[model samples]
Target chain A: MKPAIDVVRLARHPKRPTSRDFIEYLVRDFVELHGDRRFADDPAIIGGIGFFDSIPVTILGHQKGRNVKENIRRHFGMAHPEGYRKALRLMKQAERFGRPVITLIDTPGAYPGIGAEERGQAEAIATNLYEMSGLRVPIVALVTGEGGSGGALGIGVADRVYMLANAIYSVISPEGCASILWKDAGKAPAAAEALRLRAVDLKELGVIDGIVAEPGEGAHEHPGETMSHVRKAIAAALQELLVLDAETLVQRRYDKFRRLGAFTLDDGFSELI
Target chain B: MLTRLFVQCPQCQTTHFISFFKSADYVCSRCGHHSRLDPPRWIKQLCNRGTFRSLFANLKSLDPLGFPQYREKLDVAERTASGWEAVVTGTAEIGDMPVALAVMDPGFIMASMGSVVGEKIARLLEYAADRGLPVVMVICSGGARMQEGILSLMQMAKTAAAVRRLHGKRQPLITVLTDPTTGGVTASFAMLGDVSIAETGALIGFAGPRVIQQTIGQKLPPGFQTAEFLLEKGMLDIVVPRKNLRATLVTILKIHRTRPYPVRRRGDE
Candidate 1:
């Protein structure tokens, strides 16, 4: 197994294939959608209607810029309230049209900014989780790079969730965790290990459905092959998800998230206390 | 002896007799700053006398990730909060109206949503759904528990799905956003209420104020992320003060109550 920090480094590689790259390669005739309608358009998250392998689908993801200038514009792929609301709007549209929704997760969490909070960031993400729970459509989410906290889960409450081989998903970033726990940001490697954020770890923990294999080294090395794998994984998931009735699809989606937790019932402990 | 008898309000530094403060439900009489309350006090204040019966009290958190110091922290939380978990859930009656209530105690690891907290809330929602009872939750939290890692994050989805099920049954979910509701808790069930009411001076948002400040590299405007701020942004229905909370809740519950309808048998048209 790779050291968790190294996976984090690979996940954040400058040359890695971004959400835009995947959409451009796998989604044909993709028409980009913009704006939350309630607020200004957030460039951090790009969502639209597109065709995946001739199947009409709604594709959306957190888009990290390829260069410094664009990165600043995208807020380093950290979404604001508008980004989540836009995703929710597009998701509702997908449901109305019976189109399968494919979300790519890559963010450092929602943008922690004054404007974001003033516009109701929590409500935006909360609405997505509540609405997506009952969305009567096949929904698939792939953690293409970094899956950060509620921002990732905002678009991640899917029927099937997948992760790239080198990707990392965590409650908090390693640096954040380290600073809080160890009181030192430099202890990120140890924090990363403790968080168990790698794709394999998440698979074992049943937090994700499957892992898409990256070709050689990582996705940044072989973007074409890597995207092909992501395409295949998504297609496979949709193949299995499409046959179910709307009721079952929604119920199963709810159950999938409903079953995620690790705890023990200590009746004796309660009594002792 | 003076410190024990007189408690100083953290917000205003007004010292008052502990007895008087307790009688006031921990709200500072002089400055009206609402201090955080434990589950026991919350139930006593919100629920009708002797009407609260605790539920899901046996679910305890496990160090699933075996993160450093987590077990110690849980032990400390259990001791400090005097509870099994961050939330205390149960069936209760408010002004004679039966309901399900869940109160998150911020004293317990800042009431962070771990597996136990999530599972308890989810089960409470499910239990309420089964009995066709409305749920009233008092929410206060820092966010997802970091020690639990991805499992803690998953709790947000779990609780939200449970809330969805309760909504599907046409059962009402009224959430009382108290002091310091942020992060995963804010982004999940806390904000999913059919009627969201925040207490005055409560901090409610996805990201904490300090985080927003650090990200934007500027001082936040006065009263940012407060319950009043949320109300102005159209995110909350109303903001009530601590003293009026119980009465307000009772009024809301009464208004939501439907008239009794006759049940139809299988053969009856």
Candidate 2:
């Protein structure tokens, strides 16, 4: 039997999955896709088709390495413009095949290096936003861990969005936020609370559709249980979306975002009432 | 209580002495200018008469994040300052040519790019693209709104993408970076203009010089990331003063007028 799991330990000590572990555990019968066609394939974003309980789906995710060498190999999940282009390519393929796209969002955001900008990182992300809004297939994105800036949102637009309990989805990191707001990095926790970045807060704000239940307090406690819950949630979401036709799905997707912040004006004459 | 009458240029920070009650109109002595101009006033200065029509005038912000004391703070700021958000964007005519004008309201939250600001800018770009109008954005900001958090930062991408769509269509996007533009907003469309322009003495940079210096453990050079420095370094095409902004924009728009609207060949369109 596996060692007795400590919930606190699992929550407190979170680590990223390795390439092999991610491939073997999360993906079954996976077929790796390659290239942006215009440039060489970026190792930052790994995407293709796979099966979850015999249901075919497209899996797109940001990969992080276990060690220094592997981290360098994956550019520490920092993607070039081609990385976004590759994901774009796979998304188009998924649409063509009428498959639901399940994206695992885990990145510090797109690479902001000089090279990425020269190759039009901004342009690539813009293209994705324009193209994804019109995609025919259902998309369901999950924030398994960190969802950083445009890098995460580049592939994160979906009919239903889910986040793991302890995961964070933010435009910028807490440290970055603290630095910007307070001019001090030590105030990160203050920034974190101010950012309202946790899954719970996002769920409250309608930013996230749901929170995928993790095992024994967190995903790290049992990877198997976490993956199972994620698969089930995504499958259910996809099933619900698939019932609608393409036009309805598109309209629903548009309406979903449109209705996110529905509010009515409160006139200054409230005291008269 | 008598408020001090001072006319400090947003660009140069040059204080022009003026008597508090001399001009109720608040004109600067040295520069012969007003310290803060309303959006309509700026539009009138840049565009032909009666050409400007505001877009998304009905869109107001919602405190979705439930920011601590956000409503109270907003109310206080509203009471003390001009009744508007960060930016006002819409279609207008500069001389004979139809153009889109986006002017930042620095009086409001330091002209931070919150959701409404982002949405307005995006809609302006989309409208320009649809109608084949040239876009001119007068950027002045201390960057994203901390109260809005991630949503505010998303505006960086949102605005950049909106501008990119226009650019892809071969539409001209003229960014006139004004004083104190910094952070994520500057990192995006503010720097991605087809023909980038700046007001003389505007502070334009990804991060503030002080912040960058403290982070990098090095002293910044004199006039680092200023409009004059950026022009010398090729990040900006030209640096026009507040007095010349309207005329310079007209000439730039006129020069690019010869190019025909790009054919829509991209599949997404």
Candidate 3:
């Protein structure tokens, strides 16, 4: 297995294939949708209706710019309240049309800013989690890059969740965790290891269904090969999920998430009760 | 001993006798700053006398990832908070209206949600849904516990999904947003309440103020992320004073007790 810090570096590689690149590669005639309807459209998240091979799908992801100017435009892939709301809007539409919904996760978490909070960031993300639970459509999600805390989970909560081989999914960024734990952000490498955020680790922990293998070096080194793996993984997941009825799909999705977490019951507590 | 006798209000810097503050239900007598309360005090404030029966009190957090110092922190939290986890969940009676209640104690590592907290809360909701009881949650957290890592993040979805399930049963979830609700807690079940009420002067938002300041590199406007600000922004349904919270909740519970009017579906009409 790769060291956690190296995986983090590869995940944040500037040349890595972003959500837009994956969409372009996997989706044909992708009609990009815009705006949350309740607020201004956030550039950080991009979504649309498109065809994944022969099947029509609703696809969305956190978009990081390939360059500095683009990064500024995309807010470094950090979504605001409107971005989540827009994703939710498209998802509800997908459910109504009986289309499978796909989300690519890549964010350093939600934007922490005055406008974002004032516009109800928490409510926006919360609404997505609630609505997605009963979306009544096959849904698959891939963490192609940084799955940072709730921002990533905002669009995540799928029947099947996958992660790129080199991707990192964590409750908090290593730097943030380090600063809080040790009061020094320089301990991020150690924090990264401790977080067990590597794709393989997450898969073992049952946070993700599987890992989409990356190409030699990383996704940036071979985008075509990486996208192929992602496409295959998503296809398999959708195939499995599509067979279930809406009620079963939703219930199974609920059960899947319900099984996550680690705890122990005190000896005094009776489980049979 | 001196510190025990005289307590300073974090918001107003008003120093007063501990007994005096306790008598006021931890609200500052002069400036009206509501001090954080543990589960026991919160239960006393909200539930009828001798009516709160604690449930899921035996779930304990394990060091799932074996992260450094996590066990030590949990040990300290158990000792300091006098509870197994950050939240104390149970069935309680408010205004003689039986309801399921979950009170998050900020004293327990800032009420961070980890495996145990998530499990307790999800189980509480499931219990309430099974019995068709309303849920009243007192939410006060700094967000997902970092030590548990990705599993902590997963709790956000787990709890939110549980809330969705409860709503599916037509059971109401009334959340009381207390001081310092932020992060995953804000972005999950806390904000999913059918009626979201905040305590006056509570600090409520998705991101912490310090984080916003660090990101924007400027001083935040006064009263940013406060209950009043959320109310102005239309994110919250109401903001009630700390003393009046129980009465307001009782009223809301009573109103919810009425059977909801049947609505026509798209094809039914």
User: What is the Cα-based lDDT of residue A144 in candidate 3?
Assistant: 96
Name the better of 1 and 3 by DockQ: 3
> Which DockQ values do the candidates obtain, in the order shown?
0.66, 0.20, 0.74
Tens digits of per-residue lDDT, candidate 3, B160-214, equal 9999778767789999999999999999999999999999899999989989999
Name the candidate that leads on TM-score.
Answer: 3
lDDT by residue (tens digit), candidate 1, A1-273: 999999999999989989999999999999999999988899999999989998999999999999999999999899999999999999999988999999999998999998888888888898899888889899999999999899999999999999999999999999999999888999999999999999999999988989999988999999999998988899899999999999899989888888888777775542110
Candidate 1, residues B34-151, lDDT tens digits: the string is 9998899989899999999999898888888888999999988887786769999999999999999999999899999998899999999999999999999999999999999999
Of candidate 2 chain B, the 10-residue stretch with the lowest lDDT total is: B20-29
Overall local distance difference test of candidate 2 = 0.71
Models ranked on TM-score: 3, 1, 2
C-alpha lDDT of candidate 1 relative to the true structure = 0.91
Candidate 3 CAPRI level: medium
Residue A211, model 2, lDDT: 91
Residue-by-residue lDDT tens digits, candidate 2, B234-266: 567898766677788888888988856656764
Global lDDT scores for all candidate models: 0.91, 0.71, 0.92
lDDT digits (tens) for residues A149-243 of candidate 2: 66777787678888877777776677777786678987776677777777776787667889987766466657788777876887789779878
Runs with alpha carbons beyond 4 Å of true place in candidate 2:
A1-14, A18-23, A34-41, A50-57, A72-75, A93-99, A112-121, A180-184, A243-246, A261-273, B1-41, B69-81, B98-100, B122-136, B140-143, B153-269
